[model samples]
Target: MTEQISVLEKKIEEVTKRISDLKDIDSIRNLHHTYGYYFDACLFNEVVDLYAEDSEVRFMGGIFKGKESVRRFFCDRLRMRHSNGHNGPIYGFLLDHIMMQDVITISEDGKTARGRYRTFMQAGRHELAEGLTRQWWEGGVYENTYVNEDGLWKFKILDYRGLWHADFNTGWAHTPPNLYPFFSDTYPNDPIGPDEILDIVPKPVLWPDTGVLPFHYPHPVTGDEWDQNKDLNTSK
Candidate 1:
């Protein structure tokens, strides 16, 4: 009877481990999708909520820290480009696809986890720069780290390394007369000319400078050194 009881306990342990593993997998998967949703929707607040309050995010050749800085990076720099009327209309839809590859480790202590994923994003423009309409594609890999605190999983770091990027627009459409006035006098298209007849519109800036955070750059904008010790806390 004692042997039988021991066997039963072992079975229970195995089952518990499996359940824990599954939960960790799901959490990592959800994190990937959550990033895509907030990014595509331009929901800066929601994006900030996904990370730890003191998390770090490094992407597009730059690093940022804290939930506030992450929020500013997305909302102020990335999203701000749409505020202007030049690049394209803001009502268009964008689709992001993130393919998770593997979960490297789901810590038994429940304090940390790591994973890898690939992403592909496509933005479709219905009305951009007058009658000009097109699509843009960008793809990359994400190296992610998460931390469990207060029974919740929060992103600690996300490193995005670009793989490929290209735009579908070939400039086939000519600039429409109504849209011509919107363009600056020295617009690039003015000298380049157009191939086909279409409405012309001003180009929008897709990138902007987000405010910097300590530990993000070695030197702050004021030409002062950032906190050196903060580097040790980052995921690296």
Candidate 2:
């Protein structure tokens, strides 16, 4: 009878752990979704808040490291480009980040996780705006890492690979190659540049070019890792 009780207790502990992992997965998913919404609205301050103090962001082959550097990238550079230096939403501007198809993996310790998601973005500025009023379609993949900080989840690394871009009316088939260029210069030198320009192998490209943003998780069934030796373009 005592042996049976011990077996049952062990099973109960295993069941509790499984439940905790499932909850962690869902929380990580929600965290990324919230980031998408904040990004779409150009909520730079809020977006920065979602990241951990020691976090880093990888975008367009540039690495924005640390909280201050991340703030400069989003609050200064991106805000200036999208919202005319405003920290919040603006008039006659639309940037909707539709985040979906998320795959989240939690660590055994339950303190860290990795997630991959597809982001379909629609960005445009109405004619009322000062600069060129144009609309575009952007597809990207985010292979982000997260951490549980005192029971709150925050982004440890926000890595985004923008694969393709096309004019809203023209569509992707007629899209031009290298529509968006990667940063060639570092911060302070470029003023609104990345802290460090990464030496990404094979380089990243936009539209018209084929690329594969490597998966963060191993194959679920096969448990095989992606081979990175092949010349795989990091761009769309």
Candidate 3:
């Protein structure tokens, strides 16, 4: 009788473990999809909804807090520039892929969870700078923490550190037909010089208030000299 009782106890423990494992898997799977969908749709609001109100996001060397701040960080700060005729349209498409490595843990209280994953992203013919067109690929890992709030799971923290990135410059070297030039040639009605152009169209703001992250590595085209030239030309 004692042997039978021990066997039953062992079976119950095994079953509980399996169920817990399954739940953890499901939670991680949902998170993978959350990132993909948010980026694909450019759903800033929805993206924030996936996180806890006071969640923190640390990535690309910057740290941001709260859902509203996170939404603004991505939507307002990140800039993409494309040229017309000089290169091509300034805006292009993006593709993002995410792979889950593991759900490190689902806290015993079930109020917190943690996971690790890898991501590969491709940007097609996007605008990198004035008169420049490019494609880029980046791969990275994500370390995330989720919290349960009001019986719902939400992300409490997300950290993304890229491993490497490949830049394909001048990807759209060919000019498109019937496209307008980046600078207008039409005279008084048009921008006769850099001053007029700059007045009408301000330069893009590359970095945000969060000084945590280095906006980008100094590339030749976007170097100090280029910035000085832009300022000088516009001032004229």
Candidate 4:
């Protein structure tokens, strides 16, 4: 009787740990969605707080490091270039950033996690500096890493690959990613060139031709042919 009771306790502990890890996965997924919500609404301050202090954010062929760098890149440059308020009738601008297809894996130690997300974005912008409004249909893939810092998950590295950026009216076949990824002229931060980027399909992925995002997880196996190893990199 005593031996059976000990075995049951150990089994219970293992189950508890497994449950906790699954919950962490759910939390990360929700966190990613929450980020899109804040971004679409132009809540720049809220969005900046989502990153860790020494986080790395990569977007538009630019890599921004630390909280200050992320904030500057997001608020100063990107926001200034295009005012993407989702005002339906008045401005007729659209900023629908929908993040889906999350494949998240949490470390066994529960200290770190990595996720791959596909974003379907149809955004329009009206900039005063540009003196015109342009509507675009863009889709991108995000290969991001997160850390559990101070018991809260925050972005450690956000690598976004823009698959397509084309004119909504002309379509991608004719337009392509027709515009060079732009940056604000007044940006005072150190520039990180697009020296080498992820090998995206073609130069600009046209309609019906989707850009492929690599999977971070192992191939699904049958009959427990998998090792439950936790060899993920540290979330530093």
Backbone atom clashes (below 3 Å) for every candidate: 11, 1, 1, 0
- lDDT (10s digit) by residue, model 3, range 1-236: 99999999999987897797567658656865776666554554556668888887665434566676565444443322212222112345454555655435677666787776767777655465444455666566677788878866788887665554555453223323222223332222432211122221332111111111122223448564223223233221
TM-score on alpha carbons, each prediction: 0.61, 0.93, 0.57, 0.74
* Over 4 Å off, model 1: 1-7, 82-89, 93-95, 98-104, 129-134, 169-236
Better of 2 and 4 by lDDT: 2
The Cα error of candidate 4 at residue 73, in Å, is 1.3
> Tens digit of lDDT per residue, candidate 1, span 166-221?
56553213222232121232212333211112221212112111112222222335
In order, what is each prediction's RMSD in angstroms? 15.1, 2.0, 15.4, 7.5
Estimate every model's Cα lDDT from 0 to 1: 0.57, 0.89, 0.53, 0.70
TM-score of 4: 0.74
* Top-lDDT candidate index: 2
lDDT of 2 by residue, 85-195 (tens): 987889989999899999998888989999999999999999997777999999999999999999999999999999888899989999977777888999899887888
**Across residues 1-236, which tens digit of lDDT does each residue of candidate 4 receive?**
99999999999999999998888889899889998887776676788889999887776544676788787766765555445332112244457889998899888789999999989888875664333677788878898999999889999888887776677888777754325553333234344232223334233333344444455677766434333233423222
Please give the distance, in angstroms, between residue 188's alpha carbon in candidate 1 and its true position after superposition.
30
Which candidate gets the maximum TM-score versus the true structure? 2
Q: Could you tell me the lDDT of residue 29 within candidate 2?
A: 89
Which candidate, 1 or 4, would have the higher TM-score against the true structure?
Answer: 4
* lDDT against true structure, model 4: 0.70
The candidate with the higher lDDT, 2 or 3, is 2
Range of the 10 consecutive residues with the lowest summed lDDT in candidate 4: 227-236
